[model samples]
Target chain A: MDLIVIIDYGMGNLRSVEKALEKASRQVMVSHNQGDVRAADAIVLPGVGAFGDAMVRLKRLGLDAAIKEEVTAGKPFLGICLGLALLFEESDEHGVHEGLGLLPGRVELLPTNLKIPHIGWNRVSVQKESRLFDGVPNGSFFYFVHSYAVVPKIDSDVLCRTEYGCEFASGVERDNIAAVQFHPEKSSSLGLRMLENFVS
Target chain B: MLSKRIIPCLDVRNGRVVKGIRFLDIRDAGDPVEMASAYDHEGADELVFLDITASHERRQTVVELARRCAEELFIPFTIGGGMRDESDIRKVLKAGADKIAINSAALENPGVIGRCSKRFGAQCIVVAIDAKLVQAEPEKKWEAFVHGGRIATGCDAVQWAIEAAGRGAGEILLTSMDTDGTKQGYDIDLTRAVTTAVNVPVIASGGAGNLDHLVEVVKKANADAVLAASIFHYGTYSIAQAKEHMAAAGIPMRLTK
Candidate 1:
């Protein structure tokens, strides 16, 4: 049985992510404890609130270092929505907020012309062949709701791109780390398949 | 570009999906989980489960139902009704609802909107406005209603929408009480009034008789999303059919093949 630890930094609804992962047939545990996180087979960093606040909570709880250690150990780590943005170098959500600096990127507002919070299902175009989207088809609709997105400094980190106003990096991958701007838990069966792939 | 959404709303009472939800494969039509799963498979962009039962125990039932639906269904869903304060909102979201829609409670205490939006991101807080047309001497306008359209608030519908959005509400679910069960069509004027009043996405609800009515709300009223109950509950038109019709009518929609 794959024991997946969902790191909780006191932001958003963590239960939904736990339930979704459970539905994917994985044993899920949502914990803020560093020890539980270290013992997990896989780690999922799921978030739904402001980037700065989430990072503050992560640092306060010392879970940020634990996450880095787990990822450094070559464990499969997945980030969802704001969790994806947190993996970047920095964000300008309210002010300049430093992130975990896992991926080479920065988070910025979607665009002025586009909806402030790009809420709804949009089609994601898979750019490269990665295990994250093993069975999921290209151009599949995924649920997305966010005002900011990650602008990867390195082009090679971009795995999938979705067009809202302009094409944006919807999914990114680097070795054992994978993250998506869309909420896979809320994105129907294709989303579950993505989680299942992550578990495998 | 973001596409228009077709949302199927399920009215849950005592944890059971109320009204006649006639699906050929569903043995128990009143089951909220079954109804939600059916709608998800039908390609509903989102689902809104409104818990009409306001009792304490019944609210828990709704929360339990939300948890079950969230586990089974993959699409995003909002749980509304009986949401009094931030604590109530937390309970629902903790139960796996992606968003919480407050109607009467918000009218009673407008601060709850700001508090919930601030605590649980503005993107997850939806303020639902039930509006009834008010024909006054010089000009006929709409007024917001509360308590399941039983009490009328003197606040102007459009103005209230603006206030709600200003208070950090991510979206507004506007329903026309006059045409609620009439099966005529959505009040395009009311929808447009609210949509234009608020920069946030407005989900047009009530008075959806056919596919054209759905198209009309998005095309004419400029609603970001269209939510229907009876039209979809009684199987007059499936969500896929509505999406196909909207897609052909020059409305951007997510069509699952």
Candidate 2:
């Protein structure tokens, strides 16, 4: 049950996630192979690139099907940053592109008029009780580096909200699948604790 | 609210941490990895490792250093100093550094900024500018410098920042050489000038003697972050202490409590 596979679709910061996961879990593997992903007890998909490019690579590697299958089978799954956005139905990043559709949402530009990329540390204020934030305090700060955010159609899916110029869903949890737009692996102590919670 | 960042920059030479005063008089602080870990634990939002000895031969050392830091530290860290092109940037990104700050290289070929930004997403490309005030007829203007601040590029600092932003730099690390190491305060006019010109986040570097400097740069100059070395290296102020001071001064910080 300790096996945690961080899906590497030939893009993003996979090593940092793997290194961070190693601290929280006994066994962590960053693999592009669908077989390793399917065999894992839990899945962590970490991303940091464009929406359309990531989806293309995932499908090319045949990981898209594997990820959908594993998560549908009730395996605990987590997505970080772009990985969070990828779970949605579609994205309007450079142009309209389809997503995994695992979650009912659309990835759109942060409605904020302030800045393009909401880069820096921001508070993730909790909305609902979820195991993802078990020991972490409400409004704990996490490192964020993205311009777009997911707008989950289902209100209850959001676990936390972060303020830039406008509030956006920063963290979401739907049953066994939980994801965060912020990089937990890049966040400090409290972030590690949240990762530890997910693995445990 | 997205809290203003406090970043501790480590100027490394041959892989050891050193704080440089006015781009000279380098003093050894400690091992880069150990200091980086301590800063990460102390609540630093991010860390920047600049290899002062940024020769092509020594690039491998920094790459190795990046690999070690990624294995040890959790908070996002940036590797800078002497990255000439996309390949150099790609090597460090592969090794583990979250961002690549290009100063001299970007100045040598301004096109490198857009090229690197395009190849490796703008999120990971940071443009570091060493700016010094040049006395002119109409008014004083800050000009961008290169070759470790020894050579001048005649490029107006504020104008260059605007151009860099247009070219796709994720963040601008603006350092005022005049106020650097003086510790009196940050260059408010210079920082404000560039921050106003650039849409991207600007990190005010060089002059941070006390905690109030951090707040001044943020409030008066509109700096998105403040990068310090000597003060934090000598333990003049810890990250938590800086956060407390900033939070008390009405500047939002990443304080869990």
Candidate 3:
């Protein structure tokens, strides 16, 4: 059985992500322990809070280094919402906090015209091909609820884009590391289909 | 551009769908799971189940309904009502709720929004605001209500929305207490007020009698989605019909050929 470890870290939406992955036929476990993440076949970093707080908890569990190491070993890694923000170079929310730098990017607030949280369903247009969106149709409306978004420094790493007040990277893929600004777990059938694609 | 969403909201009391002109009907609409499936098939963009059940027994029944709905309904569903703590939120989510809507509990403790969002992700935390108009000496003011829109908290509805978003609420479910069952149309001022005040998606609940109401609310109030119950429950409008109406009005919607 290929176990998919969902890093809890006391942040992010763990159950929904776990449920989505479980529905995808992958054995899953929620853990804050670093050892479990390193041993897993794949790792999911799901976060939902401030960048500073998430960084504090990630360091407290010493999972920060362990996660980078897992990605280095070429395991399928997925980050959702705050998890996606934390993988960037840094974020401007609250204060300037350093991110995982796993994908070259900086997290910034969404444009003011389109509203702040960019909540509800938004269409994501694929910018680059990847296994994450295998059978999902183009212009699929995915659930989104965030005040911040990741702007990847390397444009080629971006997998999808969604427009709010302005066009922004909605999903990114760099090697085995893939992250989505929207919550695939909350995206209903379209979201479930995306999760299923990732697991396969 | 993203398609406009068509949401069917179910008022669940004692685990069954109940209709109310301001929560008056105690009769059952149908099995929540079956109703949800029908909506999904009819092209409902999303679904919301408000737990109108006030007591503990009814709360458990709502959870069971959520489990059934989640299993068979492939669409995203949000569950609200009587969620007091993180444990309560967790239990409901575990029972198949994609998101937890906090109202009275949120006003009681703003920390709940931050804590729950931190733990479950902002996407899972929906702060439901029940707003009623207060007759101002000079002008009317929006007041927040709790206990299923029975009591007023004196807090400004617009301010509460900003605060909720700041606290990490992924979405806001705003219902107009005065216009709730009137079917006159949504409180355009109230909906627009909140939509302009916060960054999260504002789901306009309460008055929605016809397709024009949905169109007006989405265009003028800037609501991302419009939630209706009575019209949907009484078979006055189907999901397809509603979307077609919205689409014709120049509102963005996902229409099936």
CA shift at B1, candidate 3, in angstroms?
4.3
Give the worst 10-residue stretch by lDDT in candidate 3 chain A.
A10-19
Residues B1-257, candidate 3, lDDT per residue (tens digit)?
66778789888777766763221232333567667766776778889988777666756776787777766665678988777888888888878777889899999899989998877778778899999998756766799998877788989999999999999998889999989999999999899999988877889999998889999999999998888888887878878889898888988787643
lDDT tens string, model 3, A20-139?
789886488899989999888888888776898998889989999999988988989988888889888899999899988888879998865755657667888998878899888888
Ten-residue stretch with the least lDDT total in model 1 chain A: A17-26
lDDT of each: 0.88, 0.87, 0.83
TM-scores, all candidates, are 0.94, 0.95, 0.80
* Candidate scoring better on DockQ of 1 and 2: 2
Higher-DockQ candidate among 1 and 3? Answer: 1
Candidate 2 lDDT, B11-84, residue by residue in tens? 88888776532311223235788778777877889999988774866678878878888888889899987778
Expressed as tens digits, the lDDT of each residue in A1-200 for candidate 1 is: 37999988888767667878897654789899999989999889998878999989999999999998889889889999988999999999999999999988799998658667889988999888899898888988899988898999999999999998788999999999999999998888888889988887
Clashing pairs in 2: none
- Candidate 3, overall lDDT? 0.83
Which structure among the candidates has the greatest DockQ?
2
DockQ of prediction 2: 0.84
Clashes of 2: 0
Which residues of candidate 3, in runs, are more than 4 Å off?
A111-113, B1-4, B19-29, B37-43, B54-76, B83-172, B189-201, B254-257
